[model samples]
Target: MTDKSRKPVRKAVFPVAGLGTRFLPATKAVPKEMLPIVDRPLIQYAVDEAREAGIEQMIFVTGRGKSAIEDHFDISFELEATMRERGKDMSALDGTRLAPGHCAYVRQQEPMGLGHAVWCARDIVGDEPFAVLLPDELMWGKTGCLKQMVDAYQEVGGNFISVLEVPRDEVSSYGVIDPGKADGALTEVVGLVEKPKMEDAPSNKIVSGRYILQPEVMRTLENQGKGAGGEIQLTDAMARMIGTQPFHAVTFEGRRFDCGSKTGFVEATLALALEREDMAAQVRQIAARLLRG
Candidate 1:
């Protein structure tokens, strides 16, 4: 789809209310989304992706002990003053902070599920279609994954989700979608099964933490019961909206790192560091040595 055809996705909701139980000790004090992928924090990458997709109103659905996540996006007067005094080139820090009224934060009282966290932002999202991004899923591409999905949303006009193929053996770990017809980069979702058994999986397509959902989804989620893990599964709610509204999965050409996992977090750092000009030589040598061993 052409750039002009891309409908402006003005608002986006970031669900940061999860208790990072997987990364225990580190997560005890610091929110997992605040953890650095390489240089930038995980949540920053998500915000960058949303901005790339033309999102204007950024809403963060957070829980307790997540002040750092909010502070990261706020202007640090002392830090900025110090950088200016030292004549440091801090342009990279420019877009990190949000201006007054441009951002909003709401608390998800309980760690219910992705759907519940998203539901918390319903009033902010209002009646328009809004984008949902899970910060833990870090995607790398020339154009952000959400940008691609936004492009597809413009053409399809219902709901667009970013999808990728995961191993069948790993199907039970993710929300898998049954893909129907293939239309260019878009795939029609026939069904959505929340982490089905390996043999029961309809297809290999997994929802990769990015979505462009319609306002109607809020109603479905409002009355939706708990699904997988006794949590209000967002996939389940979105699945109900299927056929009633058009749902398409945009297969992005990119690398996705599940930074929610310890292994995935390290992998993302290694991959990004290996690609950087300053770190490439050292990173390559270490990788080569490790391979030799």
Candidate 2:
């Protein structure tokens, strides 16, 4: 059961220390999180979602060559001044800027894994429950996914993980959940299996990138040993918390694009571009032409 007096979740952690080896040369100097989807970078979408979910502090776990990500969120006075001089609308940047003192950064010195990256923010998160968002997963919906999870967390309240059903064949790509009881969109998670093969998988409902975890999960991660891929896996730590707390899975009521992969990135770019009133017609025409050839 949730502690009625526990403080509300006001902070969010973003782990972005990975080297985008798949994108190669393009990501040589530019961090993959800085890649643009239409006009906004991937990281902006996650930050915007966190803000919408009432997250007050944005904590970033970064590494070498990731300075670009930090600068993107910082004030660019020169550019803003030039835009004002040119009589351009600056409203587009309104959501992107973080208020002074509302942001913090921690260094992930090694390329350990997602679990370690999240652990790096242990001090900032302190004793409060916090949200974790992976920028590579772009979720589109009328309401942000984290906000939906937060709403669910308010009711059930231990650890809330955003989940989505994937094909059985693709179960190996994610951490599969063993559901216990169903209650509309929320399911009681009995067990979790990280990247299990099709035959070993428990269910098709896989854990997505959004999480609402109690501070105790940080304690679990403190001595978490390496699991799959020989690295400390967040899934491993989360699995240990299932029975000890009120663990539940909230299915996302939206489309999710895995922007970390090349194909998913292109699909997300096209999907978002086609949604824009200004670019829809032209993008449709171009898509039609490409499909015909």
The candidate maximizing TM-score is 2
lDDT of candidate 1 over 60-108, digit per residue (tens)? 9999999998899999999999999999999879678898887999999
Residue 207 lDDT in model 2? 89
In order, what lDDT does every prediction score? 0.89, 0.92
Best by lDDT: 2
**Clash totals for all candidate models:** 0, 0
Identify the runs in model 1 with alpha carbons over 4 angstroms from their true place: 1-7, 290-293
Score residue 273 of candidate 1 by CA lDDT.
95
Candidate 1 lands at a TM-score of 0.94
Q: Tens digit of lDDT per residue, candidate 2, span 1-293?
A: 54642468999999999999999998999999999999999999999999999999999999999999888888999999999999999998887778898999999999889999999999999999999999999988999999999888887678889999899999998888999899998999999987899999989999889999889988999999988778888988998987888888999999899999999999999999999999999999999999999
The C-alpha RMSD in Å for every predicted model, in order, reads 2.7, 1.2
Candidate 2 lDDT trough over 10 residues, lowest sum: 1-10
TM, every model: 0.94, 0.97
